[model samples]
Target: MEKERRWTEKYRHLLQAFYFAFTNGYARGYTNGMIFTGKSKYLCVPGLNCYSCPGAIGACPIGSLQAILGSNTYRISLYVSGMLALFGVFFGRLVCGFLCPFGLVQDLLYKIPFPIKKKNLPAHNQLKYLRYVILAVFVILLTSLIHDVTGTGIPWFCEWICPSGTLLAGVPLMILNPEFREAIGFQFFWKMGILLVIMLGSVAYYRPFCKYLCPLGAIYGVFNPVSTYRLVIDKEKCVNCGSCQKACLMDIRTNQTPNSPDCIRCLKCVSACPTGAIDSSWNIARSKFESRLLSEEENSPNPEVTKTTLLAILTIIAGLATMVSTFKYNLDGVLVYHFSGLTSGRGVLAYMLVTLFKGIVSFFMIITGYKLFINRNDENAVHRFREQTRMILKFVIIIVIAGIASLFADLSLLSVMFNAILICPFPIIGLPLLASAASSTDKLVQGKGSAVLWWIVFVLLAVVTSYIAYISTVIILAG
Candidate 1:
């Protein structure tokens, strides 16, 4: 019996590790410019896998939840909600124990060879409720509420808080994309700080994020009592031993409540049960019977909706201000033009960096303006026009800055690289934005020749830019 229990524990760990590897097998550590953009990305995985990971083939449920909520549509995505509900109802927190990449990370972190001591600190139990608070405020309320006021919603939790995302996706992307590294600001540092704290906490506590701050975990946990898959306690076979509770990483009092909300369905309790009193099952009737035997309600504090509203409003204002400042700074100062005699190697590198920066900035600006235009109601047409004008002014300022910098140095290589990067991404990103903007303008103001004229001018500019880039590249290479 002891040997069988040991094997069960070992096999569970191996199974979890297998699932982690299987889910992230696309790039498989070959972090070049490789990302799986296949059809599988539309599907949400049952675990917290970062979509930005080079190897990830599926979207993260929490990230998707936040994104749909924060969309301008302001409608709940039945597809995403249905997926989450299905996963929760069927498997409960088994997803956390046997699937989540971050859950596996925490488990491995806890196993490091150190004098690891588990302490039941004061307020530890209360901390378990924090994930629910995060779910309510960041994942659901903030995303749905912010779009009404800002014309654009922020994925507040994913953008500002997800440590798993920072570690799994942000770090790898920054390492791979030099342009993303160059664009890093205070937010990157803030996220790294959060990731660091979580890492350190994971070393000491078992599944700290799952226990205290995973919104997905909180979501799955709600179905613990009635989920089709469940952990059951056989009172007839029980010896009043506390071994199962001791084995539980989630700090679940399994002897008293087998299907506790905090349980990860890890089966550690099942393995540790001395008299084989604990078992797992897939019967709805059994789950219902077990739930009746042990009934406990988890009490969580209600979120302050008023405070959340005020914070969301302030965040949008602050974000817009920051965006303007960052855009101006990137355009004016990100590229440094050397007046010294440039070597071929140095010139090429410098040209590439500047071009990359310009491409990224242009893509963002066009997308932002496009979203504002399309999402604006008739009453907000003037506001959208003003915003678009400001963006255009910013673009003009960037062009002027580049022109001034060109005068100080040999711009042959720089101009070629800049135009190449600009023209390539502009069509990919700008075409959609332009089409959307034109469509929106036509609907709002009929007989608007201004939109048509602007479209013609943009086409002309693109053609001219592409021609210049092609000619310059040919000339430089030939020389």
Candidate 2:
């Protein structure tokens, strides 16, 4: 019963992690609104995953690593490596705990109501080096075959390999969109089979990929030694009964040191420690909360709003914004086409209005997103929001990159502006808007029309941004 209380919320954090991994809003600003039919946005997140998955918001690290290697011009991807460093310094293996959607998926898979127990499978601890080997092989293959000499290698991991991208984004989308299904070939089947194997393996192990083959884990582990937050073992309170080691799914010997990069911070052993010797703190500082809490709800915010609901709401807002924006921009595109051969300025003005409207919508999105973070009392919400914001910034960056590319491809100022606006929603302003609305609604119960008006504006902004983005894509492609 005690163990259940301590670890009940452990799964919740994992749930939020999954949400961030799959959901676009969490990864917003991460991918920069650049879909990967490919031009030259080489370099993705430096992890084991692939980017071609539809759910990915930011560039996949492994994909980006391969691209950097493949490109002769940029010898190394300083940006991606640096981002990983920054992430590790602050978060450590906590990334596995809070940000990885794949990790969350594995956790969910493990909880299938089937009887499962932690297995102590011992092998060469050196087996942990396999991800680096994979990284090295990818780099060698990609860099060695650089197409500039013959100009050919695109380093096709996402298309030819990558189970996460295959399972989460590729197969499902292909099923839903016939064009994608038709695009499938032998490679798709091969990848799907591999994904099936990994899915089954994950059911038996705590996290097979994370434990064995995740290059991102290896990189982040390097920084865990000095990261701001880490696990600390209080030797003074030591009974050293080996209960922690017994409980640790990672097989960590937590008595001596608890900062192993391999440790997932799942807090299982923390709960298992009979002497209360194990603790988590930032920079060796003392912690406010202990390993065991009497009530699980004490750690959560608005227990009423589950992590899934937060994820759903975020997705709804982002999708709505994109959809609404797409519709409005398409309407404007039709009007502009009608006026194109006649008076050019009218069409230009109309285009500009569409662009402006998208910008407004983006502002609302960014504002709303940020506001949610500000008021996020739940630890899971805070964790998810931070990653979401980071990814949002990245998303904006890629959109800016894409916008520049559009310029070279003869894309219009209005179109570029529209894309830029649609891509960069003002999540920072979201908190104030929500707060004001809440306060206003509470004070003026009958005058709810005003609150509704605010919501309508918010919704309209999203629509306009999506429309502008959709129309811009059409115009760019058509031209």
Error of 1 at 42 (Å): 1.3
| TM-score for each of the candidates | 0.57, 0.53
lDDT of 1 by residue, 215-257 (tens): 9999999988888878877889888688987888777779798
lDDT of 1 at 368: 50
Count clashing pairs, candidate 1. Answer: 0
Model 1 alpha-carbon drift over 4 Å, by segment: 1-6, 119-121, 148-150, 283-479
Residue clash pairs of candidate 1: none
**Please, what are the lDDT tens digits per residue for candidate 2 over residues 1-479?**
44553764466664665556554343433333223443333434433444655445457665676666566667566877777788788878877766676777777776665565444235738766675665555544655464655554566555454677776677657755667777788888898887887677677767776776666777787777688867778789888799988887777887766888787667778788887777666523532333332244466654424432443355346535554554555445546665664335544444445444444445545564556545555445544544454554454454555445545544455554455354434332443333344334333223566547456546645654565567568768968
